[model samples]
Target: MTTQTSTQAQVIPKFGEQKKAFSIDKLKRLVNAAKSMSDFDQAKRYLCSYFIPCSNPHGVFMWRSEIKNLEHILDKNISKLICSITKVFYT
Candidate 1:
């Protein structure tokens, strides 16, 4: 008698498709660093660049306290979009 065994296919993640581990400590550090800078606009641009992944530049304000501040920097529509995106990532 002969027996046959089946092998399962291995899954490979595409390039840049892998999910990065999020660290709140790292985020806090970055936020603090940004805050220390003299130019808020320049700092915000840098922060936004760091936070956004892939192509489009999306502002990611991680803290709740920052929402009001971000509203002042960015328009209400952009803030709302960022808020929604942040919720999806965190939750």
Candidate 2:
């Protein structure tokens, strides 16, 4: 006798087929606003959501793929913003 659990697996949704409520631009802006604020809890909330697998699954994969994948999605202005923000917070 063979018991197979085929339907138990969660298939990854298509790249563009995720819910409309999930906005990449909104997330980026939230991260920026969070970074500007002085509240640790608020900032942590935004950043953690972006970097964590639960909220931003693609983000975790992109971050894991290294700088190339991230840079490709970031574009010129976003890259600049990231650089500026990092300079402010990291150094």
- Number of the top-ranking candidate, with lDDT as the measure: 2
TM, every model: 0.22, 0.24
Local distance difference test, each candidate: 0.32, 0.34
lDDT of 2 by residue, 10-69 (tens): 232333233333345544444454433452333344333333332332323223222223
lDDT score for residue 50 of model 1: 30
Residue pairs with clashing backbones, model 1: none
The ten-residue window of minimal lDDT in model 1 covers 1-10
**Which regions of candidate 2 are displaced past 4 Å?**
1-20, 36-91
Candidate 2 pairs with clashing backbones: none
- Report residue 17 deviation for candidate 1 (angstroms): 4.9
